[model samples]
Target: MSKLIIGRYIPGDGPVYRMDPRGKLLATFIFIAIVFLANNWQTYAIACGFCLLAVIATKLPLKTFLQGIRPLVWLILFTALLQLVFTTGGHVYWHWGIFSITSFGLVNSIFIFLRFLMVILISTVLTLTTMPLEIAAGMESLLKPLKYLHVPVEQIALVMAIALRFVPTLMDQTVKIMNAQRTRGVDFNEGGLIQRAKAFVPIIVPLFIESLNVALDLSIAMEARGYQDDKPRSRYRSLHWSHYDLYNLGFFVLLTVLLIIFREH
Candidate 1:
């Protein structure tokens, strides 16, 4: 699995790590939308260059991003294959009974692959650089206007933060449970798909119980600490808008403009 660490955060000192999480979050979303603006090699190059630049800004090892992407390789490839098979037109290189490898399909598949890759890249950059608490705070602040519309922005943010924080914890617990079962002679990979799924039955039942107990314990602890959803709260670490955030905004806006200018008509 190469350790799926999508929601895992790495402690580091760098420009990306220092930038406001709110900006990073906003940029991640905006980038996802803007990535589709590229339709040709020229446009794709520009968009991909921006992604590479943003990645380089993180100052984290390339291996970290590679590990995060490795687990998704098959999914991305499957999507690309769908695009390659279903898309039609342009010069045909090879043709079969129901599938044809046309130049258009090939290019479109590559574009689809790159778009998916860039989106995951930006999201990984956000989660990797920002802490869970900071992400929650950023989300809450960004959604603050929703309070006027009666949305529980704080609770939503809190849930998201908790979910992110628990991803690694749950993964570790799953691993531990699997190892314990292995010690008891559970053969997970020794049989076919059905057999492998059956092997997971023991892991799933105990893991579910453990998860419930953990959640109950957390709720109890929060109750003891007097945490309330409706109460007004102040952060021990408040978020502040900075020149760096403005710079990030400008950088992405410039990229957006470039995409618009260069994209196909």
Candidate 2:
């Protein structure tokens, strides 16, 4: 809930931004699979190269991309630590009580760290390049087949759209509350566990109240329009897959096939 992510989207006209969101989402999954397929340093190097090539195509600054990763640094470190301390097979480098470090553990730790970073890096690219509403619309359109099964596709899409819009709004409100508390002499960063828990009360209470008000207002507005969950709805913008989407999807399929083949080896 910081302005940190507010300006996270670096505006640029690039091939990555131009690609269909559905295509990028599918490609990201395939790319993550390739990263996991890597069993050695060589394959990991290839994965890194692929990720770098993707970033280059985005036309966004390297610093901006790296900034998006700052939040996940702790998660990556924790994953590496868990693998290093628990995984045991190869020659041991160190031992103490129930804890031991081995070559296999070290190798696995590195691979796991790389895997986590790669997944987050690719996903961050998706959010950075595409607007949240577009992603929701794309997902809804892609899942249109569910409509024939009596699923509330349009309602689900509306929920996704609202959630996306609320993310930034909620973030901004959190910041405001933090700043207000800070003005009244509150220190969130330098607090002990209990103090920190108490500190969040001020911020969370307001956020909950404000969120409830917004939800009520939205529900009322929807009811005013005779909105029904299962009713058919028309989209202001239609979704269509272009040649680029088809080509990219084919590339992802090929990549997945190659990854599976090489991973088995």
Candidate 3:
């Protein structure tokens, strides 16, 4: 179960790891927009280039990045298959009972599959480099203006931070529980869909109880520390937009403009 989580951070002093989490989040959104907004192969190619550059920037092993996408392989394939069977354009390449494949569908499927792969890869890279706490802080700072609309920005950010902070911990715990069951001759992977799901019941029930207990304890601890919604929060580490962030932002803006121009053409 621990191994199922792909976004675990690996410590490094690389340029990507040194970047402001806020910038990374913004750039990821820009990259996603570039990919999804694309209507042509050229734009997709450019987006792929940008994704490759991001992977290179991270300085992590290529294997690690590829591994991050493994869990998503089935989803990518499923989406591609749906597009291939449903998209109606160009000449039909193959036809069978209640199924047909066309040139347009083939191209669309490949593009969608690649786009999904790139999105996952980019997000995985972002999470692998940035710490969860930094991400949460950056998110809160970025969304601070929303408080003007009477939104509970602090509480939302705190919840996100806590959730992110516990993902790895919970994953580790799940793995331990699975291993303990396996040692008792339980086979999770050998069952049919319903049976496999049933196997999770034992694991999930324990996990849910433990999680509730932890949440209660955390709330009590926060109250004991005089945590209050009316109070302004300060951080030991602040989110700052530096020259590098500006440069990245400029590059993304140019890329977006180019994509728009290409789409018009």
Candidate 4:
């Protein structure tokens, strides 16, 4: 759980760490969108190169990103397996009992695996580079126009920020709870399908209680601070759009164009 990168932020002085979160957010979204535009080796190769560049730009240890991806390795493999077995098209190599591998399926499975991996890597970069508060601020800045429609944009952004900030805390709690359960003679991995599901009950029950307590504590802290969103609030730190941010967005745009051009017609 600690290995998961959903909300983990590593402070650094690298170029990527210096860009505006809004640009990072938009670039991440665009990268994810353009990933689907890739359909062949050339496009996927470009996509892979783009991912490599992003990871290198983070200027963090390679192991850090690899650890973030470790937990999802099986999921990516399983998805690839399904695509390889069930998808049918092109030259069929083998077919029996709904299990078959065709040329199309083989190609598709590779693409699917690469696609999943690329998305995960890019998302990990975003989380590692940007803090939850920055993410919320960026989102709120972008979403400010929604307030014209009577939407509570600030509250929405605050909720998202809180969720992201709490993810690592929750995961750490889950790990501790799992360890406590293990001490109580519960084995999460040493069980059958039903038994494994039952094993998680001990972990989940306390984790839920812990989550509630955390929430209550947060509420109290906010209340003590006299938290209010009815009006504009001053930011302790302000986000400024920079040329580096524009550069970040532009690189993704170039990657998008490359994918569109190289992808299968």
Best model number under TM-score: 1
Task: Give lDDT tens digits, candidate 1, residues 1-265.
Answer: 4477797789988788878988989998899888988898888999889888888988999999999898899999999998998789999998888898899999999999999999988899899999888988888998999999999888898788787778779889999999999999999988999999999999999999998998999989987999998898777878887888898889999999999998889
Candidate 3 lDDT tens digits, 1-265: 4565376778877778878898888888888877777778888887788788888888888988877888889989999999999887789988877678999999999999988998898898889998888878878888889999999998998899889878878878888888988998888998799999999988998888889998999999999998886888776787777776877777788888877877636
> Residues 171-244, candidate 4, lDDT per residue (tens digit)?
88888988888898887888689999999888889989988999999999997898977967777868998988
Q: State residue 205's C-alpha deviation in candidate 3, in Å.
A: 3.9
Distance from true location, Cα of 238 in model 4, Å: 1.2
For all predicted structures, in order, the TM-scores are 0.87, 0.81, 0.85, 0.81
Q: Against the hidden true structure, what lDDT does model 1 obtain? A: 0.89
Please list the residue runs of candidate 3 whose C-alpha ends up more than 4 Å from where it truly belongs after superposition. Answer: 168-203
Q: Give the TM-score of candidate 4.
A: 0.81
**Candidate 1's TM-score:** 0.87
119 in model 2: Cα distance from truth in Å? 0.8
- Candidate 3: lDDT over CA atoms? 0.84
TM-score of 3: 0.85
Candidate 3 local lDDT, residue 5: 38
What ranges in model 4 sit over 4 Å off? 162-226
Which 10-residue span in candidate 3 carries the lowest summed lDDT?
1-10
Looking at candidate 2, the ten consecutive residues that score lowest on lDDT are 1-10
